[model samples]
Target: MVASCATCQQKAQQVKAMQTNIDFWPTTLKLKNSSDLICDESLRYLAGKRLVCRGRWQQRTVAVKLFFHPKSAKRHWLREKQGVESLISNQLSTPSLLFAGTLIDGTPVLIFDYLSSAKTALDVWKELDNDEARLDLLQQIVVEISAQHRCGLWQQDLHLGNFLISDNQIYTIDGDGIKSSTDGKELTTKKRRNNLALLLAQLSPNYDHLATPAIEHYAATSQKNMRDLKSITEKELPHIRTTRRHKYVKKAYRNCSEFIRHNSLRQVAIYRRDADAGLIKQFLNNPDQLITDGTILKNGNSATVAQVTIAGDSLAIKRYNIKGIWHILKRCWRPTRAWISWGNAHRLTISGIDTPQPIAILEKRLGPLRTSSYYLCVHENTPSATDYF
Candidate 1:
């Protein structure tokens, strides 16, 4: 009878906490172990479900993660706690977890020491200009990853963004992605191959030279004999790339983190989320005028190509001009070649192939029918691959 009442009270507390709105920042909450926690800035947010914020706790600035969902929150909370504990037990570098427990009202909360000056590995990699520096960075990253695999753990969503650099050290973040495939034993050869391939697949084939040395370093650090290292990565990289390409292609036509999608009765548009919205709007509004003012690359009857500079970015715009009334009758009932190229370009990108990024695709439409379409991409000054080869 006493146990039943405790369970009921816990449920009640969770319900009360769920009522507390998380969308607004500078909100205060009572922590069970420390002072009243004040969440001042949202570092990352996922609607009503999860929030990572910088907050004040115990007279110190700390990072706080609050899980608002009632049913699934506890599971994720325990996973994060277990992941952090695993890293600590394995002597891997990660942010120290200060506290892990429910809030006063039973909302799951985790507090950690915040590294103020840390930059994500992705940002640091982007700043590196030369291939040698980039290779050195990759070496350091794969070595750390090899250590984790040896310790019987690997990040399921391994990527450069999950690592933080501070004090000349790389600290892995996103505890939730840390997964164990073995019972405190080194990962099996198959697991190591797949995990390493997943990370390598994120890089273009232009980095092919880096992959050999990186895998060699992994084998050396993990003490694993990978006589078939070349065969493994060769077979696995394409498979991973194809899988990722398929997934990202599905996101190309929708509003996701990487792409912005807009649709209307008269027009439909899709663009990269990181693209300059003002420039895109201006170009789309007066594409012909811009093409007239910009440098012309091609001026054929059925198509036109122009190079334009916008917001300091050199861009190539191609307009698939409407041929005539007969062309409209056939093309208006279906998607244009430009739309196809836009999706194909994204496929190439996701497959770790070198190609200019497809920034946006716009189409003129009558209801569901499509007419003239435009494809936008980053301008490349190099010679065509066929001619160069």
Candidate 2:
């Protein structure tokens, strides 16, 4: 098998290390085009490889994209540049690029006029409390998307977040996803279906019934008969779900956008990336003792659950007991119930099904095999359905 060169290996490690640092706060950078710019807090961070921040450049408020991915940084930057240029050429409403420059550290960055009053379509989605308001928002989004499709351009990352709304005017962002046809023709029906399905599959299942109406809006905007696209879109959804589920399940076990992991021969522990490290360390030292001090919800031989307060956060921690010799042998070779619960909680969370926020999962393992485990989640205070009703 061919092996990567040492330089490639070092760069890969650096990229991996950067992904773990989520607090990549805005900072000042010396640019090649204008002058040194100071960035404010980040606008959005995606998968740790790309960052969007708004800051002042050349005495104007500007939005910036800093590409830090070692392998795809330059390529994605070029694609983004091309996409923005294509949108402008097609007369699409989008932020005009002020300058494309490289940082002193050789990071590729794009600077644009910051839309001060604008909010992402995803943010707008959150405020639409009624079905009519939501469908209107979806119509606006698909209309803009329809315009892009008509111009032989499509966003690969075709999600609500890529569009921005300002004064009722919608503008597209994230040019890296701009895809174009070879012959500059409109996207085919199947291509449109898949792209639409990508967005649909990611939507919270609360909107499952809205998918057909959404397509109707898209069809009306496109001015075509697209009754078949609905079926095609539905057919494409499972693939996206399977892919997303597999990717998210992997992230739950490692130091990624959402969770952090600590590996050792004795045990493997994963905690929420935003969780307090000190509190986790304290809880790790003696979880049983910590539970003893809290209000016990269920004190059973097989499992114990308690309402514990740690570092000012109300948390519920469940400890899966070993029970007996047979139980110990069975669980030792596989994931404890605590481990499964942790995974399921996160799965529900990412699917947008409401569940308690999972804070940590501890697997007490002997080398590779596992024994008893503990699961920690934020203690929610919402009333039960029966009581609320």
Name the best candidate (by lDDT). Answer: 1
Q: Residue 17 of model 2: what lDDT?
A: 43
lDDT of 1: 0.82
Q: What are the models' TM-scores?
A: 0.75, 0.84
Per-residue lDDT over 56-127 for candidate 1, one digit per residue giving the tens place of the 0 to 100 score: 888898988887654567788888888888898889999999999978766788999999999989899889
Model 2 Cα lDDT, one tens digit per residue, 324-345: 7788777687777887887788
- lDDT of each structure? 0.82, 0.80
Residue 224 Cα positional deviation in candidate 2, in Å, after optimal superposition: 1.1
Off by over 4 Å in 2: 1-26, 46-48, 232-234, 276-278, 284-286, 324-326, 381-389
Sliding window of 10 residues with minimal summed lDDT for model 1: 12-21
